[model samples]
Target chain A: MFEHTENINNEEYIPETYIPTAVSHGTKELWQVFWILLGITVVDFIIYFAMGASMTRNIIFILMGLVKAFFIVGTFMHLKFERQFMILMIVLPALAFIGMLVFGLLHEGNALSIDY
Target chain B: MSTHTTVTNTTPTWAGGRSPFNVSYGKLMMWIFLLSDAFTFSSLLVGYGAIRFSYSGHPVTPWPDPALVFNHFPGFHGVHLPLLFVSLMTLILIISSVTMVLAVEAGHRKDNKSVLKYMLITIIFGSMFLGCQAWEWSQFIGEGARLNENLFGFTTEAAAKAGNLKLFDHVHWDMAADRTPGPVPFASLFFIVTGFHGFHVFSGIVILVVVYINALFGTYERRGHYEMIEKVGLYWHFVDLVWVFVFTFYYLI
Candidate 1:
């Protein structure tokens, strides 16, 4: 059998600079994500005028922002196509930290408002 | 060497001979950097939220309504046009992101000409977004939105008038009569968060320009890969992602 492992010992085998060949996944999915994002932004614009500023409205806007973020990160950044471990490594910690900050600090802020 | 050969056909992903994530080292590092950047932005946003919430019931200097402060659009002075210019800016950034991803896709195909074309388009749109931000900042500052103090605290009379305002309704803002000193942190946070975001967009454009020049010189073609385009594309899209939240929390909410 051909010895493929021997190439690792070769002088050309520089692990630090190793770059895997990239493949074109075409632009179809990218365009779809773009439209979804644009559509959501439009909806956000319409909703702002249609509804008064309230907690529900703000929650809706935030949810839509997350949806837009999903498309941007998953497709535009190609994180969706990456290995599962890579996705988990980047996503899990961010979710945990951001969630903690939002809940914890907002609660504290609410307490401060009560005292004020 | 014999054991290595035996494992070659079924090499585990973590066997140390390859990238387990299956991405280039540069791309992996870019993701890590972006993750850190995300945290920085999150902290800023959370801070803004906390500060704004703390001023909820201030009798003298209430947190200003964004609609009153951000209602001006270019060529329509004295008109109530909330969310119009910012929506345009958001669209610009989104379209630029699309073009950037297109450039990366072109790079994947090794189509240097197409890549250059798309990169130029992305740069133009990015610069347009930056210009919009500059105009918005100027409008804010021109209306007395200082970092140390806010001038958007409308009197009860002005608040009543503002409540009746529909889009594009022309109304003069007599700053001296209409408003008082308001929450200091409102203006400061606005400048800090959006300024940081605008700076990111600016740097992304500069990076895009450098990459465009490199592509013009056939640098990636000579290297037999276009991962550099992918790396920059990640940064550009990250800027867009940040803008999405900024629009939501700063304007809509």
Candidate 2:
């Protein structure tokens, strides 16, 4: 919410400007992200071992993985403060690749036997 | 003529650090390079997935059970080690990334000593991870895990010593029996591809060590910037990103 984009720069001078020795977030917010990551990873384990159809489980896991991946990319990678153009530059290609994977998956099932 | 003098003396060749890309010169290039490398790794993992499924079933098989096949060590005479080694590698990479960040910070502060110290730490970490990967490769190659075929599937495991083996044929689950193991071609492929990636980590470690040596000699200090640290950090993080896909495809799925 308190995102600032002006810090993105190409300054040539090597100055130690605004280096916070112990920069940290409030416990509540930090813990929220931590728990979310933990919860998703746990869900990943479950969807994997949940003993459902492999196709269904695969979808679930992929979606969960993407969710976790975005949280990590946006928050941990510090892309939240970036401008919209920068955000799209970083994310859109990955999304395009994911789209290809989904399409490939649809056709890939032909490679496997569908035993009921 | 007079204007030429003014332009040469007054106009700045450098934009004083402005770019239409809206990111630092080093950082933006890093992002693009990482993006390209991401596709390379993605294609490798996904191609493996496609081929593995394509041969989901064939005649003469002891289908590779990832759980049983990828057993790595946490200790001696490993009692069916899980993907713990991969996790350890991940931890090492993450810690190195942290150290690299510290190095970058030190570079900004012109703290040459701290920069060298942290970069050295990072190089050590990258080498350690590479060592771990080499051990994993040895285990894979040793004991002769081979690409096998059976009635239902083709998999990586020890092939039949003398007879034509078929799918679902009964063999001892333990490695002690039927020890006529040979090099699995698929296993070799896996080792080569992943091994080369590990080699890159090794290469990066060596480069970092060189950079540390240079930092000790006041190269960056005299040059007046630590942009090299940022560039190397990019290379390091790209390595980590590649592993994320490798984990999901190789270990989990």
Candidate 3:
């Protein structure tokens, strides 16, 4: 139920409910991302068997997980095409909060183990 | 009306009358919602890490190794296939994500036929993943993993034997000989984290079905935009994103 009106200056004026037209952007990039994600997953599987359980292996898995998150959020969710401000608004807060929680609580857990 | 000016590179992003994110109100809200959801999941995972770490030096019942506990595979009875079945589940979720993006891409072109097709495929794969989770949970429960207790703990002898076992070897659990009660939080956290992620997948499937029905009736076609698909697509992708972390923290580590 959007009202269509012509501005006096002949410029298209987008109203509050304005939804810009959807464009196809083709499926090429989507497929490329799919392949890259699958490839990294395969690497994850291989490394799991190839390496012993150690902090190094665990760090590798966490780093690869972050890389996968980049693709899924950037391309699959279409955040990469959004405005710069929007990207920072979503990404920065998450990194800060999650990072702090993980490191802080894990240190606490390690201390609890020592006391036991 | 005459005061309105065309948006250009020099225009201040926060100026009124337009979306600073260049997304519709609904899609932007979906992103915000997902950001909040991410925080919720992070808390659960971080808590899990803390509890697990605290169990490291328990003299009576050391923390159970995940490989020994989650080694069963369908049709391969007693085989020690750690990480294999969950790996299959990961593949299913990732493939379904691809189909969902394809559905959104089809929506972009206003191709309702292709949209419905891809949507159906995505829903099917989503359900398939749920089925796998159901089986995995049944196996865990059958082995006496409960929210209040963990029966997967091994005696020193059994733990030594488990360390020497190779892939594809038969894994027989002798409750009396091998298992003692384990850290209570291990079983509890497993259920809470995976259960939460599973519930999200279930809800995502329900939402996708509703979106698919709407498209079948030409709702998006009549509305002149397929942004609904895009919005729901964002939610579905968010589900997949959460699974990546769950798979990493819960299973792989």
- Interface RMSD for candidates 1 onward, in order: 4.8, 9.8, 5.5
Name the best candidate (by lDDT).
1
Ten residues in sequence with the least summed lDDT for candidate 2 chain B? B1-10
* Local distance difference test, candidate 1: 0.89
For candidate 3, lDDT tens digit of each residue in A65-91? Answer: 999999999999988887678899999
- The residue ranges of model 1 lying beyond 4 angstroms of the native Cα positions read A1-13, A114-116, B1-8
Per residue, candidate 3 scores C-alpha lDDT tens digits across B29-148 of 888999999999999998888878877777887778888888889999988999999999999999999999999999999999999999999999999999999999999999899999
* Runs of candidate 2 exceeding 4 Å displacement: A1-82, A108-116, B1-18, B57-59, B145-189
Error of 1 at A53 (Å): 1.2
Task: List model 2 lDDT by residue over B184-203, tens digit each.
Answer: 43465476558657867877
Off by over 4 Å in 3: A1-16, B1-11
Better of 2 and 3 by lDDT: 3
lDDT of each: 0.89, 0.59, 0.88
Can you rank all candidates by lDDT, best first?
Answer: 1, 3, 2
